[model samples]
Target: MKTPYRLILLCFVIFLTLEGSTPVPTEKTSFQWKWKENQVLELNEYHNVFFRVGAKTVEREDKNRVVMKPKKCTPDSCLVNSWFDTYIRYGKTSGPFWKDKEFTSDFTLFRNGRYEVPNEFTMPNLRSFPSFPETPVSVSDVWKLPAEESFDFNSERIRVKVIPEYTFQGIFPWSEGNYKGNCEKITYTYPIFYSKPDGEKMVPNVPYKIFGFASGTVFFNATRGVPEFKEVKLSYTFIYPNGTVQEANFHIKGIYFLRNQINTKDKESIREDILGDLIVGYTGDPNGSKLGDRIKDHNNDKEPNGKNLGRITDTGEIPRPEKDSSLEKLPVSVRTSEDGIVFSLDSILFDFNDSKLKPDAETAVAKIAEILKKYPDREIRVSGHTDNIGKKEYNRKLSEDRAKSVLHSLVDNHKMDEKHISFKGYADDLPIAPNDSEENRHKNRRVEITLVLD
Candidate 1:
């Protein structure tokens, strides 16, 4: 026998509870599909290299920019032209890998939660945001995408199929203002299925089957008709024909904006950072604001007292070369070992397929002569290497000739003691880099000068 007021309160409480448990429909009016013309997006990526070679760490960083030039736009479909620039930097060295490559893409922003990626632009695979549902998808929603288009690989046509799944993770906060949005967490567990032409034999000890997967979270900024940000983790596994396995992992992050905002301070900061890091970016001193002038100043800066650089120990350990002084000032790298110091000059000591010393080579040899004059008792060893492009015998001959040329230059031009110096040639055997690409092949051809503490 409840009272009338008590009965009314109970009903009201029940109504509120039901409403709280129910799902809220996505607002269709807020969605905008693509960015406007002249809008630009700047992105920075810091890669922590966990992969180790013996005991060395190879850390890297990359910077990229994308500028939009909309050719056509509509609620159902949009076509946008873009310019992309990517620069990669490694300890003390950096350069442009994609140096302002341009491309065009067509997109369809559907009412249902779906995204379509550009067919070309395979280097990045999914360059920009893929499709997302127009309506908010819940954790219960099972997302799927159309199979990716086929492509040619290694003179054979290859096919790839993709299976995508999505889940609503939570809300993502915007950086510009107090705007909070939905976050969709996705995992492509069986992301790609690769298939090659029939009758293709798998090489033993080489990978035959390769699989890829990706997991990431995308922040839905529906009002802008694009995602605010996306962070993805990608991985690939290679199964060799001999049952061995290898894997690689990559992290990709992206952020987008609807309008162009000019910030001079940020621009200046980026400029200064790039200027300081170009080559020897980690150690380059900022002489002035102007990059060219600063470079000139750095080049002019010379080492003091070059003769008092390195010393020999009674325990027979070779001493470290003085930095920014004698050999380090040249384009060559000086490395110390237990018995001696090795000056490694790859392609810098000689021209392609020719061992004849260039003007710069003469200067570098003169510097070495000065160092040798300081240590008359130390013996020298010169070794040369060539890539495996030509016949093995021919390569051996070339390498030997190159080593002799360097030795002669030291003995004749610089008057280094011929008796104290010895030379050897290792043709296409001991390679510093894989001869798979032109860049790496170029690196394989090198000359080394070692000063042994005898």
Candidate 2:
């Protein structure tokens, strides 16, 4: 339909206006980490500990909660105190329960992109994402992260102070509509840079350098002050002066969020979400079976060479040793021995390198005393043994002191007659296990309680 030129031109203008009214997505985006004081950030960290023996992997899961609280804040910087609240192992062969062990530290972070750590405390694989730029950034923008940081390696065998360099590898939207919501993927890489150990216990003029490499992805949420997701894989190589190379690889993954203290109406939804988290905790590593099977196959392949790389069971169903019924009857059982009816207390009864009995020791001693009261005329003997780690004389005295400590605990705390009880120490001369490995050495440290019928 041929219309007037003026009318046609008006129609074209209207079309253009309508097209322009719709918002067009921009390629550049900006984010800021303006954390406020008293803000508490809670994170669930899933750590995979793998001891790489040749090609076989002995893997286990170490899970914990990392809590961060801002202590003080300024216009451009803030001091954050972070601590591990609880540690839980997924498998049966779990390491020590670190619930009572407090590993807390603080660091200063700046708005202008400066991350500083204390000289004394260094937590490996614990770091925040690189700071965002003051201006908007596009894809393929490369930048440098904060430096002058330190990390511990091999339980303080060596320390490395490093300045990290990073390149911004573009950002993308992560998890559109889940609990994590929309997040920004901040990708970066840091090379292996080595430095001398700057620890307090580091000897002067030591001829060795600690080297390491770390690479990771950090996901940041626009509304939250902390990263919603972070995964970092760290590899460390310790070079000794005597030309020994010890390597360690660790993988750390974190899912973090802040509590919605203001949301009262969403209480039901929050409860459901928390129940879901609890289910995940019970499940342990979701992929533990598949990964454990792969490791087991690899270890089995190496068994032809008489190599026992040990079992890498599923963290979900790691096998634990069967309970011994004899040990269960320890408190009441009185076994016949050359001296008399004897009962034994292993190193587990006491703290390491201390004569003081543990809290549970009192209950055990009470049980033993109850049994001994039935045989009032029998004389009791408490003997202590030690592993061969110290001087002969010192070990002998330590054993004697430990035996006397137990004897005194029975007499003073349990009101047992001192006249019918005696104590002795056999330091390192007798051992239940070989003193080669730590487990054997621990087994060698024991105390026996013998009751004489005379």
Candidate 3:
């Protein structure tokens, strides 16, 4: 009696030791990003006007194309204004005014250059103008002012000023100093064309030559003056032909320049690192195959060498198959449902109302045993189930016993390793048929085998 009790206690101790020695798997980490408000730019109506010195007329022929000759002036001192209008015949369609409307002024002229008008200043009416080779006049002939005047034709000696107001909107109080403000100015030169009534054409010397001039720049300045939401106004002044001045105001509304805020709540990089480590440790693809391929492709294109090299793994080595289990040599199959091996046993394969594997189940169990022997390193899981015929608790125990019986054969009779085998017994918890029918209940009583890992 003492020996038996001692033996049981020793077994119990061994079970406890084995249970405690089991490794606890690490939990995976995920990532997300958070965004915050930065700054905004508000614009208004005060920034909407065009200034030039040209005649307005009703005669359609003379009002086709006009040019403004550049003039010399001191910085921030000159101001001029003029009205411009194009003919609009009844019952006609036309493109946008900005596409057809054009202005040419020579602030300075060292060498002659050609200017192409922008498409934004289109005529309001589709009424086509008579196409003439000499319609657009030259800048030299346009200015009627005397040569003695200071605004004479000298593009290099002229100065043009464009002042644009851009409002900044922000979440922080306007007076707060938490955020810094800055602005950038960019200038683009393009060709633009305009039409003026022939009689309204002011420059007396030139009547039908296209005047070439440089376009102005767009300015954004936070320190100079900020635009308001109501009516942000920007002024542009041009001095042309012997001290003559022209000015225009552009009225812009709802113009805001917002900057991206610094994010503090994001631990995405850390989380991604964690996930990447986990995936590499499990799936062995630290920089995922798809992502690594993309990076490699992009780098190859951008680099001068442009070599199509494969991705480098996290361990600073090219990803390759293990020597023992090369993926290239593995057999692959594509089957919709019944692709791999199948295990089937009759109803008499187990004891009545119990999960114990009977003598008759030997054939089926032998087949599975052979499979396990063939794939020694593979992990197998055996699950036992039963029909809804008895009490839930009783059925659960029976199924568990049946699973244990099957596992015992594999481990003991077939000499399979116990570490690679797992067993689970679920009574009627998961069913293959409805309990209302006898046929379905019978179908539910069975055992299943799965290949977990290789």
Candidate 4:
């Protein structure tokens, strides 16, 4: 053990040189958003915002379906456009408030995740993790975000400067959407501090100051070159002049899923091919459908109720599909996904390898249409799928034909509006379970009609 100190020192030097020559996991490659033309990614976001104002906890759960596609690109950045279908559902709030909005917007995003969104959107949660570093970042590396920001104070508006920090938390196993590989994790946090403006004390404005913090974690899948998942929460504390305090919290979670694009298109395009167009399509909300129609004295919106309990029309009861005996007997699998309520009709709805609807399937679709009329304000999407039974190209066309058949029946026969409905075929790209067994494969070969909640 005491052979020679010089030899031991030489061995240590050799080990250090070997380690230095080998690049670290993060340093091996730079992280960038590699959005390709005709490639589409859907971000299904679920947000829960609750404010603990004194004793009451006002809560809300809203969903967003944002379909993003690369429009045009330069060497450094690209113009990304998205369709935003969002809806809000308030619980135990001041009034029964519901909103269904659909719009299209544009964004300019760089390779490092820096982006400029149009004034149409205010996505605080999406931007919780600031832009990525310009250079390669190794594990434990830290950076400071732009700290200057403005907000409304109790008495007046003010802009303050504060430091927000982001750190590289190294790589971990990431398996989401269609990609599976090592993923980089980034964590961010920022403190909230606002001293009260110079003013007199009052009951409504007694709170002189508020302070809190916001923190979250987001994952970046290097394989896909995109954000994989995100979870963020923000909290604030309001201090009253009497030394008492009130608190509020906001939480959000989002997941990104990439759609499978058609590989061959002898005639038709593989993707939507609508990326070059920028049409501001805003289907009006359900303004004509009064909330009071569904609830008795729910919002006290007497305008609709007029002389009767503030409702559009009072039947003294609530109408629900689950209560309809005839509709409840249908042989359909209804479930909820990131997209919303999905009514899945299995391959039995059609003959083997056929897109035409069976004779009995028509009756089932008609019944489903009747139920769909209840959600007139919601958007509907008809999607076709199949098992891995044949060539992908054939399956793709078959799925598309099946989806179109259902869509036409809903629109032409049932008199359903076509403006709020759309259809697509995914071949065998999406499967509820593994295609290892006949039962699972049968589940894969199904058509799903979803009510877009976003």
Best by TM-score: 4
lDDT of candidates 1 onward, in order? 0.48, 0.53, 0.33, 0.58
Across residues 273-363, which tens digit of lDDT does each residue of candidate 1 receive?
Answer: 4323312213333343454444444456642333223322222233454445332333555655433566666575666778776755665
In order, how many clashes per candidate?
9, 0, 69, 3
Best to worst by lDDT, what's the order? 4, 2, 1, 3
- Compare candidates 2 and 4 on TM-score and give the better one: 4
lDDT of 4 by residue, 39-69 (tens): 6666665566666656766676655667766
The regions of model 1 sitting more than 4 angstroms off are 1-34, 37-59, 91-124, 127-129, 138-142, 147-159, 174-190, 200-207, 239-245, 260-454
- RMSD in Å for model 1: 20.0
The list of candidate 4 runs beyond 4 A from truth reads 1-29, 90-99, 118-128, 147-163, 174-182, 193-211, 237-246, 260-454
Q: Cα-based RMSD of the predictions, in order?
A: 20.0, 24.8, 35.7, 23.2
Please write out the lDDT profile of model 3 over residues 344-436, one tens digit for every residue: 233456767766666545645655576557655343556677888879988888876777777788777778765446566788998867888
lDDT of 4: 0.58
How much lDDT does candidate 3 score?
0.33
Candidate 4 collision pairs: 85-454, 86-454, 305-311
Model 2: residues >4 Å from true position, as ranges?
Answer: 1-27, 53-58, 86-100, 123-129, 153-180, 195-207, 223-225, 260-454
- Residue 96 Cα positional deviation in candidate 4, in Å, after optimal superposition: 15
Q: Which stretches of candidate 3 lie over 4 Å from their true place?
A: 1-344
Please give the distance, in angstroms, between residue 272's alpha carbon in candidate 1 and its true position after superposition: 21
Rate residue 69 of model 3 by lDDT. Answer: 15
TM-score of 4: 0.46
Number of backbone clashes in candidate 4: 3
